[model samples]
Target: MAIPGAVGASIVDYTTGFPVATTGAAPNNDHEAAAAGTADVVQAATSRSLYVSAVPHDLLEDLIITTAGGYHLLRPVQTDFDSRLVLYVWLDRAQGNLAVARLRMQKLADELIAT
Candidate 1:
């Protein structure tokens, strides 16, 4: 994975605020809570985007949050299964490359949708 120092990854359903699947280490070792929190982050970002005239788009591609220790990437999955789904990836700031991680995440999302 190009997402260096990845701590965890998960597929979450924002509509229901639940994790569909998860892998790796999640915050507090709780994937379910992490997924739910990720859904909230996605919802807030999407809602804010609607009010911004700069980029008027119905679809939310991704949301990135950088902390002192790591980076969080929230990618909404455009799948036949559910549009409300999102892919969440956590990476260490020291090792992860944001640009590469974004591309890799997109690829992961595409593969997920295809399956």
Candidate 2:
């Protein structure tokens, strides 16, 4: 929750649709459901051709879903060994800067994979 306006955060395994770790209040106070939902969204995003980049061989990096009250950010964790993890964050729109939060998440995601 160090990111500004972040209310909740989780590291989810998209391959298994499971939460590896979580913090703060989850949507509906259920972290498992949240993780599964996140996995579904990420899966849809990565699979749909509409979301693909024009550049050849391009891959999905992140996804942002905005609601009236908050923003849900999803960053795929790319590792040399595997690319099945995602970092998810829930940020209050009123208190969050989308660009900044995005950058922070990118950095955190990089650090996560570095180790």
Return the top candidate by lDDT.
Answer: 2
Worst 10 contiguous positions by lDDT, candidate 2? 46-55
The lDDT of each candidate is: 0.85, 0.90
What TM-score fits each model?
Answer: 0.87, 0.92
* Candidate 1 Cα misplacement greater than 4 A, ranges: 48-53
Q: Report RMSD (Å) for each prediction in the order shown.
A: 2.0, 1.4
Task: Write model 2 residue lDDT over 52-85, tens digit each, in one string.
Answer: 6567888888899999999999999888885599
**Per-residue error at 70 for model 2, in Å?**
0.1
For model 1, state the Cα shift of residue 21 in Å.
0.3
Task: Report the Cα lDDT for residue 71, model 2.
Answer: 95
Candidate 2, superposed: residue stretches over 4 Å from native = none
